[model samples]
Target chain A: MNSQQIHLASRPTGMPSQANFKTVDVTLPALQEGEVLVKNTWMSVDPYMRGRMIVSDSYIPPFQIDEVLEGGAIGEVIESMNAQFPVGAKVSNISGWRTTFISDGSDLTLLPAVGLPDQHFLGVIGMPGLTGWVGLFKVAQLKPTDTVFVSAASGAVGSVVCQIAKLHGCKVIGSVGSDEKADMVKAMGVDAVINYKKVDDLTQALRDAAPEGIDVYFENVGGAHLEAALNVMNPYGRIPVCGMIADYNAETPQPGPSNLLLINTKKLTLQGYIVMDYWDQYGEFVEQMGQWLKEGKVTSEETVYHGLDQAVDAFIGLFEGKNKGKMLVKI
Target chain B: MNSQQIHLASRPTGMPSQANFKTVDVTLPALQEGEVLVKNTWMSVDPYMRGRMIVSDSYIPPFQIDEVLEGGAIGEVIESMNAQFPVGAKVSNISGWRTTFISDGSDLTLLPAVGLPDQHFLGVIGMPGLTGWVGLFKVAQLKPTDTVFVSAASGAVGSVVCQIAKLHGCKVIGSVGSDEKADMVKAMGVDAVINYKKVDDLTQALRDAAPEGIDVYFENVGGAHLEAALNVMNPYGRIPVCGMIADYNAETPQPGPSNLLLINTKKLTLQGYIVMDYWDQYGEFVEQMGQWLKEGKVTSEETVYHGLDQAVDAFIGLFEGKNKGKMLVKI
Candidate 1:
């Protein structure tokens, strides 16, 4: 039997291209006593992975040259030797960018069947969902009456952030790159949606949207979005920095918010966090998100590509703001 | 009786000049019921006052044009109509930039002798002392094993911050503008001192001083010093912002740290706070700091100006880095 895998051929200098990755076919050996041969179904492509592609020390190690690039993936056990990993069982794992793989079962998490689609475990019920929840309730400490401004509010993590803030009875304002994304985020019940592409000054747009000033800012896109948030933040405003996808591929360091002194004048707090740091909250997150799904209180969406060959484009599409929600590759 | 007061004559474009203030002699009215006459002894000149000099809404109201400028002041009650404030009793009040004043006794806090010099209450046992304590244990959440970096370490608040962190058994690194200030901070038991004036690259200097990453950064001077702290901060570090004296006089906005994306990569928390917000903890701070002062565990210092005529010069001297510790005008 054979499996196909994507390897990081070289590190990128600026925006990454298909030339940075190489695909290879590998002949699978017989599984060892504790190993399970699993076939991957869906793989996630995220902005944080862009950080991992560079050759430097970051929160996580950079992807090595000619090694299989890894990320969130859903798979089904086709052959198993361990009692815990029965054949036909579906699982969520991190050994992505491959169509099939043999796992020792340590890195795999069994996904319980709740009648929702299995690929959702890669998005709304998984990392992106958890990121939104933690960034809102824990990091930003969102209050019931807090006026929240979420950048990239139509994307996976941000979409959930908007919905969760709304569920908490917060007044939500969102910013998106296009009118189509604006419509989608508005459907999620945001109080106002600004199409940043059409706006001359994001700071003025935020002021127009939130006349009373925002109490919490969920920062995803960093550059001007962060500047806009700072301009209209109320006293004691909280900013939970989840990602800076806007500057992830910049050849030079982007200038930070010039109004950062307002951090002292307004007594603001800006905290940066990665979702992996909050794994201890996973079970609680899954339960609450599952209940929200069951009650139809929240909606999940994805932009999907059909095969592993489209993985590179799917990842690149994220930087171009082409994805409506979670960008995934269906293998 | 006549009282001399310094009023804000005009707002400054960049650095304030003596021409921006006007001194006036006015005959004070007889004390009303429950009023007292406070003869000012020592008045504090702080960096935060620079923010108030600008005509804009901040955490506190901006100093109004042609209004008497007021801040932390220590005075002796000369005549009292209130039984709680007897004559000859020292108190800490906010009716500063003046030699004497008639007060309603509501704004006065009676000072206890505590066997120490009375002016110590204005620095180590007063607002600046309370600021250092609150910033260390409350805002930054400093641990005993933590490594701390203090900017403007020879100034009023940063001096106490260095001493308190040292008493708590933490490795402390301090930055000052000159070797004289560096020696003063070193006497406070800091593990290392970086004379920023002598260093070509402050970031490299900080890296050399704190070979291991710093756990907390007490921010007072917020330009290159902040940039250096961000570069050497450990993962999950805390920054309690107190002031940005470095840019307080800029006519145009100064760009913030360009490498601020490290806030996300390092999972850093930058919090801005003012001492006024933490007044509820004053009793605890005074009690602990009082004991430390008595036991010789901590020492207090001040640079004094002789009279009301030098008040403007004393305030302006702060920007020139003329003072070693608390900068006060002995009126």
Candidate 2:
């Protein structure tokens, strides 16, 4: 069988371009005795992928030049020798940016037989979903009375944070790049939405939006968003830093918040976390999130590219804020 | 009876001068029933006092202009009508920058008779001591295997933190301004001492000091110190921010660490804390610290300025790094 794969052609200096990635056609290897063949149906392109494109040590290894890129992907076992993952079983794995691959079944997880669509498994109930859950409930320790502020409010993890904070009876303020994004976040029950692109001063806008000051800041965009949040954060505020999409493409390290002294004066706690560390609680997360989806308490949104050729575009589009929510590539 | 008090003449814009304070003589009021008269022997001049000089809401109320300034002080009760505090009882209170005062005995704490000097209660065995203990054990959750980095390692709190981490079997790296200060910190069993003033690149100096990377960064100075620490911090590192003495005197807000994004990449936790919030644990701290002092496991250092006239100088000297350890005024 033939498979299409996206390989890292070169490391990007600043904002990644199409030249940084290349699509290649390759013949798939026959599945070994304990292995299964997965035909990837949907692949996710997250902002965090930018971190892997750089030549540095991080939570995950950097993408190697001239090698296939990896990320969250939903697949179906079309041919399998492993009893644990029989033929026709739907699965999720980190073998994304590819149309098909043979896996040893250890890295693949059988998708639960939920009523949600297959694409939802690559978004709302997937890695992004777990990120929002852990960052809010575990890292930030969200309180019912908390006034939560979410940056990148229309993005996958951020949208989840906004809705989750609202469902927990907390007041939420969201920051988005455009009017459309603002409207989308506002529809998710965000008490105030800051169209950051239209604002002259983000700090002033955040201060006006969160008059009582934010108790929890779900940090997705760093740079100005972090600076603005620091300005209006209440004493003892908590910041769960999930990603800094703003600085992801910067050639040079950006200057941090000037008001960082507020961290001390305000007694703030800023914690950084990666989702994989909390995978032990994935079962518990699926149970609750699955229930939320079934009851219409939570919903999923996607901006999907159709082929492997557009996968690179979908990933680069994340930095440009072209996607409404989860950016995915459908094979 | 007469008392000499140090009053705030005006709010300082940048680094404070003697002109910002005024020493005035006043007749002591007659002590009412249940009140006690205290003659302050030693008063502490802390870097955190600079925060109070600014007219802003903080953990503690801003020092009011044209009013008596307040801070940590050690005093002996010369006269008492309150049964809880008798004459000759040594006490500690926030009635400093003054020679004498009449209190209702509400804010005073009776000093433990551990055979240490009366001024030791103003430094190592006082609030600064408690700050080091709480920041290390409570906030940073220090481990014996941890490689600890302490900024301003010759200052009151930093010195104690260095000693405590050393006693706990942790490899300690210390940053100090002068060779003398570096030697002082080195004498406290710091594994590596970096004279930050001598280093052209603080980040490189820190990296060279702790090639293994620091697990716990005891932040006393911000600005370059914070930036350097971020560069050298290991994955899952913890920062317990006690003070930012370097930025305390800046008229304009300083830019934070340019590498603040490392907080996310390294899964670091930076927590800001005030010593007052952990006062409930003061008894436990005193018991442990008192034992350390008695057994010679701990020692105190002071840079004393005699008389209330020199109180303002002592306070101003803190920003200039004039004090070897605790800056104190003996009245």
Q: Taking the tens digit of each residue's C-alpha lDDT, what string does model 1 give over B1-331?
A: 8999999999888888999999999889999889999999999998889999987758888999988998999999999998899999898999999989988888999997578888888898889999999999999998999999999999999899999999999999999999999989988889999999999999999889888999999999887888889999999999998888888999988877777778899999999999999999999988899999999999997999999989999999999999999998999
The DockQ of each candidate is: 0.79, 0.81
lDDT of each residue in A196-299, candidate 2, tens digit only: 99999998998888889989999999888999998899999999989888888888878887777888899999999999899999899999999998999987
Per-candidate local distance difference test: 0.91, 0.90
Cα displacement (angstroms), candidate 2, residue A257, comes to 0.5
RMSD (Cα, Å) for all candidates, in order, is 1.3, 1.2
TM-score of each: 0.98, 0.98
Fnat (0 to 1) per candidate? 0.81, 0.82
Candidate 2: misplaced stretches above 4 Å?
Answer: none
lDDT of 2 by residue, B1-331 (tens): 8988989999998989988888888899899999999999989999999999887768889999989999999999999999999999999999998889999999999998778888888888889999999999999999999999999888989889999899888999999899999888877778999998898999998888889999999999888889989888999999998988878888887777778778999999999999999999989988998899999898787788998888888888888888887888989
- Which residue segments of model 1 deviate by more than 4 Å? none
lDDT of 2: 0.90
Interface RMSD (Cα, Å) for model 2: 1.0
Which numbered prediction scores highest in lDDT against the true structure?
1
